[model samples]
Target chain A: MIKTKKIHKEIETLITGAGTILISSHVDPDGDSLGSQLALRRYLVSLGKKVWIVNHGSIPSKYMFLPDIDRIVRIDNFKSEDRFDLAIILECPDPGRTGDVKHLIGANMPMINIDHHPDNSGYGKIAHLDSGASAVAEMLTEYFLEVGYKIDDPAATQLYTAIITDTGRFRFSSTTRKTMEVAGRLIELGADPRYISDNIYYSFSESTMRLIGKVFSKFELFDNGKICLMALDNDMMRLNDFNSADTEGMAEYTLFGRGVIVGGLLKEMGEGSTKISLRSRNSINVGEVAHRYGGGGHNNAAGFQIDLPLKAAQEKILKDLREIVNGTV
Target chain B: MIKTKKIHKEIETLITGAGTILISSHVDPDGDSLGSQLALRRYLVSLGKKVWIVNHGSIPSKYMFLPDIDRIVRIDNFKSEDRFDLAIILECPDPGRTGDVKHLIGANMPMINIDHHPDNSGYGKIAHLDSGASAVAEMLTEYFLEVGYKIDDPAATQLYTAIITDTGRFRFSSTTRKTMEVAGRLIELGADPRYISDNIYYSFSESTMRLIGKVFSKFELFDNGKICLMALDNDMMRLNDFNSADTEGMAEYTLFGRGVIVGGLLKEMGEGSTKISLRSRNSINVGEVAHRYGGGGHNNAAGFQIDLPLKAAQEKILKDLREIVNGTV
Candidate 1:
């Protein structure tokens, strides 16, 4: 018996009692972060509360179509005189995950932390964290429904995007019966699944497509196809006019090959440095490998930056991956 | 005003009264058709009824991991003396859609037609057609739940696959609130979304990945990027050791480029023949264009064959696609 109902009531009371609210989420905001921020902002605005969404990073081009996306402002633009009675941070394990937005909040101001990360730091005054929830938007949607808050069409679409993307279109193990039920309710409230999907997935730029083609064509399999490696050097990025943002979700493509237990994407970040993103299946913990290289993430997906050239980084990572495949690591 | 409950009762009575049953779906079975057939067969088997699933085509390699996929035998294996008292055809608009399996059914045998296609011919003694439904699996899940029939783990998994694939992982316009709710119920009944999605999506062969790379690398955009085209010749297929089945779902990749309203895939068959698969968005009905070439499909997707070389076929289709982009045809 989790006290989820009591937590929801407390969060609701915090929202209603506040006059001015500031909302923020983790940096490098993906679909889940941006969607949850916008959905929560929309709902709070509907309650006639003065609300502002400030984030450390700019919105990605792919997520620009989200409703009220423009409402999110950069942390650099925060005014010193602006005071918030309450702060609602979503999808962040701790205040540091919100990046520079934490500096704008007064030290004594109450913070409402809503997150679904298993490692949430529980730093806020009223923290409502559920690792079982698929996404922060899932937690928010549940709270809204439990407290009888009307989720309008825009808010519903935003939450729907958050759930689908975070749960990998509801195919992730984190997705629950409650996730699907909330998504269904969002649909009833006017979230057009086709419209949102087309905007998020079908709007890839030509450069991104070409980059993907090049990357896929050059992918190499190792350890009898148990380990798959894909690289994006600086030259490939410059040639295709690609940027770091375009490589956001390409890590998943490495695991598409059959019999691939561990997949890695080696990205050359100029100089002698390389960034490696790893994905694994069959209970192989890539996060442990990432930790060995001073990186941290979930068991299935993780990344790290190395002070080595692309070739050197590949060799090092492949050695470890091979050991892991052989069950010797 | 709808009599769905009454229809469910009639279908229930029909199921309970049947001694021996045969389950089948449209030829060239996809996830929805195969899943619906398997789910229905499993449910009937639980009822102590002898149920056999006979299909016209073999299951695709990607769907071989489905629970009890081996239970679905090809039509060639049906014995002459194997007569069934009740024939339940799923996802088929008409008997012809079932191919040779329809020939084995006795003329006087009672047939139950279950489909979600708008063009259903209503060619059964008891037809339950609802175009609004996302998939036949959705309809069956609803029926089973309503009649208090237990959906075992295998049946639930099959139904979940059918719903996800038919709805494009819940991103298609056909998906509705009811679809999500039913999917939630299936999840509660032991459907593992991650396992099903992994088997259905992430099990691509090496040749398939190489083929996709080549296709994506050579894709072309016309008419200010609104029309995108990709081609696969025999030489390319042979070089990659690929077959026709490898091209499954490749048509969707054509529409992935930003601003692409019309997308087409041209495959060079032997003897100077070509087959074209077309996809469109923003209400640009590709079916109408396919009809001009004597092919047929739904509004957003369609296909046809032309008696010309790859280059000539590309030229001819490009001309029509240009006109379609200009709204002239």
Candidate 2:
């Protein structure tokens, strides 16, 4: 608690001291990054400070419903003449994750690194990184509470979106008692959970829905149903007009089968290369498996690329996965 | 709040005064009904009370992981000689909803009707009905808190499951600040949210996954993409070895498309009959549509049956749905 208070004080000092603020997060901004950026921007703007939210990538269509979403400017659209008194880098492990936004930040510029990732490199002059937080938005909510700032409805909704998406709607292990409490408070502050969830989860393109169907239909189980794999080849993608970005979260579907311990999604990335994403349910560390295959991730979720055709990649990876499942079971 | 306190006192008195208790919920038990029963039974059992959880239907395979779920007896296995000092009917609007369990309760026996449904008929001797609550488990959590009872881990898990499933993981409009607060407290009491969600959502049978894929693949859009329909005929079911129960939540998939205002699922029920489930996103009342076809439900979700083949039913329902969409949009 004391540590949180100390960090909140440091962040408050930075915010109060700044006249013009710049906010950005990692490339391919997710709900957490976008939400955290918008939420903090809303607060800073409310304080009569000039706030600019510049990001490397355009916001995903699903998250376009977030309040003040139009205010987020892409790196291509950001004017080079723009400057800031302070920069707040959110949910980024390192400044490099901010892409071209880093180039805009001059050396010696005061930066506040706000993140929940444990490996955050502590790149800023002041940092408030809580590894235990479900999302950077959770940390921001704590900071707002500590500084006695009343979070308005729009900011509450944005923060709530960040928390829900990052924690997988509170089903992820990172979801703590504090996360739920923060979400509850957000709801009280006028964050409509149903509205936000409807927009984020229910709005799917027709092609995307068809792609999901095709992908799910091809799901294969091996090693006595302990290892499940869902492979999407170029043919399936072309037929459905699927974008690679739509493959997000599809890897988790592999673990939906009853006995599945290790699940994987193999995407044919063209040029005889296959990108594989793996998720594990139990003690089997998929990260080690990914590492052995020149990829890295957390124990439960990991990924690696194989320089083989989809069919050959499946055949080769299944042997190793089978051996692992056999050894574990 | 005062009403809640008064009912809490009444419930406490009834609970303390009873030595042997009987618990049951509506037929075709859901997570809310099952979770509420188990949580209540756990608390009562901890108090040294002899509790019998006799339900009209068997527990679903997905909920088998709930702690002490084996203790719940199907109405067929309920002992004829068993008696109860008090009967607690949960989530049931009327005595008839309990099926044969209603026959087991003596006419003079004290009963508690605990429910969150607005139309609960006030069947029992002492009823505690709060329509505002997300689930019966939410009401029970309030009761436990009001009575100063320490919710154990197992009960906390049960209650947490009840809240999540009923509130659609806190995404449903029924979810409130109190619901999330109670869920937070449950986590603090040792309920593992990830474990519960995994067991409830991610543990899909291979056959069910295939069925879902097939269903999604077959989804049809009409009326300028405002109406979506997914039909499952006998061939699809037989091919996938699909159970009718697996159709649960499949109707929601119809509304997943971006422009979809109304969605319907048509299932072949044999004997030249088809069952149609409908879900709506906006002001179009699906219940009214269902009522036109001799069925009933709420505004957003409803269902009805037709003495027609799946194809015929689809054509017939699509016309009406098209008119409804055209009229509204």
Candidate 3:
């Protein structure tokens, strides 16, 4: 466990003393969490420390253009004896989020938590957490600024990615002046916004496009046009070659129509199980409803998985959304 | 002919004086040319004037989304009694440019030349022209500001269309500080940048996706690695249900590799002629070469049509490009 002191001081000591620190994030990570984690790693390296970063999961092929991605450990290819003096975690709010790396980190190194998620429970010995921020990368960005580290390209890109994903590319309510400030800094640091945006939010793989076509072709608008949903059965997902990660931003499509206040994606993950992501563009608390389903997130966007048949889960979720939207329960 | 005296005043005077003004461009109009033409028409209407604009030939379907497209005139629609006080030409550098609507401009009216090509020969009586400007729309933007009319959503959208198309969404060398200033003004005028950008650049029809897939499958890089070409024969076009406008920006795909100095799209436009669009990202003067081949455009991007077999045209063009890149005669 990390030593008790100020989180900023402890992190600095660990990173400086370790000579080499390994930074990591949970599996199937997104821009915000991953960007926060990677930005920290790059910042430390810039200070002359050897930094090792590993993603417990595969990098989204869309983000393959990022710098230092090649250095991020994936297969490890090392004996368990190899050790890191410190492990810094960013964004992921839970200790169980170590994914496959938990087994790897169990025997060696003290872990530190640097997150900005309300759900975080001060899980590590050194927790630098703030839930008020829109993204954990913002916290790290503040840290970097405090330490007099300039916002460089790698740092900017990751920070930009973090902001974009957390703020739904600046369309969500959490987007604030600070969000714009971070984005502007990134742009000044030579982040190709159109390149980043087109790849991240516009362009898609052939299979992903096919899956989107299939899903939208069957989209249903309900509750007097206030709710919109696209459902994908297991068979359709398999046929279209859609990965679980591909559904990452699928909930966003429902917000296109004029009156789709509540939008969601319901995808069958396995037998008697479905994954649901909810998005509310305006005037709805999908988060409260998701909370009822054992999920919690911001008032506008949240998600949960269901261990029930597609139809049954769909019915229950709709009822919960109705209650929340109508202020009945 | 539009007298230079008439050009010295405000925009309203031009709209008022030109009772039945005609606007037209060369065949295969792009977003910049079309956006400027259409936006001027829409703005004139806001001033309570009735105006007529005709495209001498056909405006490719890619530009159909422009504001006043339906009002565009064609050769077949010309009337024997058709007369105008002024004819405003945009981007079209020369009269009788292929299917250009020279027939629609009665001999009695003076034409105003609004263009951004160096080859323009002071074609009209009242010319508001700057070849150094990236797009004709940039000129119209200045006109809009001088007219003292408050910029609105449609105006912003139109201006954005002009800037985006001209700059390759701000990546081309033509993107200047002036372009940025104009864009900033439009954004301040209530232009939803993201909304317009997503619509124009991101939203593609299903047919476009299919066509893109086919194009990728058939794309070819030249032996020298300095040239890339995609040729869509009429047969492939028909099979893919593609429109000529869908081929509008296809040539840009080739500027990707390490040394790809020139990229082109040569399409068999039916009958005996093949249409060609040439793009050189840096240094090469494709426009001068286009003029030599009976076409003219900017220094870096230009187009021409050849009445020859597809293979013959491709070979001739490639030979020329190889010579140009090698600085050989």
Candidate 4:
């Protein structure tokens, strides 16, 4: 239901006609972006169409389990000699969102943009933007189904991972009956739910566990427990040798605390820079709050970077969050 | 499709004929046990049956969000004069698993035992043991559908919680297409997935967070990272004022570490007493390990209580776990 007949037909025609295709997603790719890109690349290669997956940044260690992950060429490693008749920019709102890959999209090359973000800036010859869809993988699943393409186990597993990550394991509000139905189909196609969950969520490094311990140890409540904030200092990060990937899901910790309407994680990214992640419950829009800080995301989960001391950043954010809570109340 | 004609018909007859029904489940009732009980009680009450929902142990604070949870009387508070025409025990493998409630099951009153455990003893007059089902809640869902019972929001939510907890939010091997189909139907019936996930998994008390910090701080990996063990001493528990509920998912922490084939959690219960929870990956059967120690559970997860001191208990358990790993490899 997510796919329009014309767009679906257009995609099928492009894939069939193109001798080679280039695929990519946004910078600092998450599971959905990587999984969707890998899935499409695999399907195209299976059909005997030459495919090259190029991305702006290195894939996270956690997502290395995806089949053919090594096939994804980093922008730094890409050569101009690579030939591709068509390019599929996945999950990105705009061409620039693909980072350096935007330069690869020549004026003559046909481009198809597949995305599910609500604020997608349509920027391709064929823009298949299903904002109602849970993930871009859902859009890809619909397209594959529409073309009657036989999805293999590898493709199904990657797509399933994309759906799982994007929908937060089907706990997000975007998850509908359609989402569950698609997941069911994926599982039937040989996507092991338990295997994917264990690999993605349970494979925590010792250092990562220590970092999590530090986060929980520093947890604090504010505004009569309406707001929660936890900080991971530069020293802790340096001691544990953890990166952004290691701190994934740390912001949601605040949401777990009783009476915490807003959960916030502040990471000291060094040299007066702090990365702040916010997760809100109910009508409180953390995205709007993030927008004020020159960042954007969904209503419930959002983030922004501040060029201020960690303490100052926390104070400033708390002042704004308290207002949001007070106004909403 | 999960419904069997004979079992459905029998359950329908029992419910219709019984004016007053007593419902109970195993001691230390989990979400699946409690949720299934609450759901069935709600459905029967809607049909104008007087339901006296009784349980041997107190319900966890985390599960108090269920509709009319206050209605479930604890055995400590139950009066002997209370009369019931029928007793429905849920999720328990046998009558004795219901703890002290086994004594309350009169010889004359008819009993219906609904369970999904493979080890079910079939103690009831009419035992509806669907071992293929994911949870007792799944059985209840099938029965409700078979008899054309209208599942209200409360009942649907409870059942949804039951399925989610039993199947580890559909990440366990027990999750099937039918399980997802049933869950989708429950969501359609007004079961809020996000609300339930947040409340059950995320809602941790401040003390609970401290307890988690304590657990992580003491995390240890032995046998070249094949075995993981963490401990929460009585000193830490007393200092943080944490109860049994505070340590709900602590055992799972061990399974998250990289290269961990076996995960163990040791809790100092009292003087010269320690409780051990074991979780294993793949072929490593923690249940067999627990059985050796006079405890019993499923293949991957199991537990036992030791009369020995914490250090001595850990040494013995770790030695056995190392042997299991050595033998399997």
In order of appearance, the predictions have TM-scores of 0.95, 0.93, 0.62, 0.96
State the displacement of the C-alpha of residue B46, model 1, in Å, after optimal TM-score superposition: 1.8
DockQ of each: 0.79, 0.78, 0.06, 0.72
The residue-level lDDT of candidate 2 at B122 comes to 89
RMSD of candidate 3 to the truth, in angstroms, is 8.6
Docking class of 3: incorrect
- Across residues B131-224, which tens digit of lDDT does each residue of candidate 1 receive? 9999999999999988888899999999999999888789878889889999999998999997888787777888788777888899999988
Weakest 10 consecutive residues of candidate 4 chain A by summed lDDT: A243-252
Q: lDDT per residue, candidate 4, B107-156, as tens digits?
A: 99899999998899988889998877888998899889878888989999
Q: Backbone collision count in every prediction?
A: 0, 0, 6, 0
Please rank every candidate by TM-score, starting with the best.
Answer: 4, 1, 2, 3
Candidate order (lDDT)? 1, 2, 4, 3
The better-scoring model by lDDT among 3 and 4 is 4
Q: For candidate 2, list the clashing residue pairs, or say none.
A: none
Predicted model with the maximum DockQ? 1
Off by over 4 Å in 3: A1-26, A29-54, A60-329, B1-21, B80-88, B92-99, B102-148, B175-211, B224-226, B239-242, B252-261, B280-285, B298-301, B324-329
**Model 3 chain A — which ten-residue stretch has the worst lDDT?**
A1-10
Query: What is the C-alpha local distance difference test score of candidate 1?
Result: 0.87
The alpha-carbon root-mean-square deviation between model 2 and the true structure, to one decimal in Å, is 2.7
- Candidate 2 yields a Cα-based lDDT of 0.86
What lDDT score is found at residue A292 in candidate 3?
77
The lDDT values for all models are 0.87, 0.86, 0.69, 0.85
lDDT of 3 at A315: 86
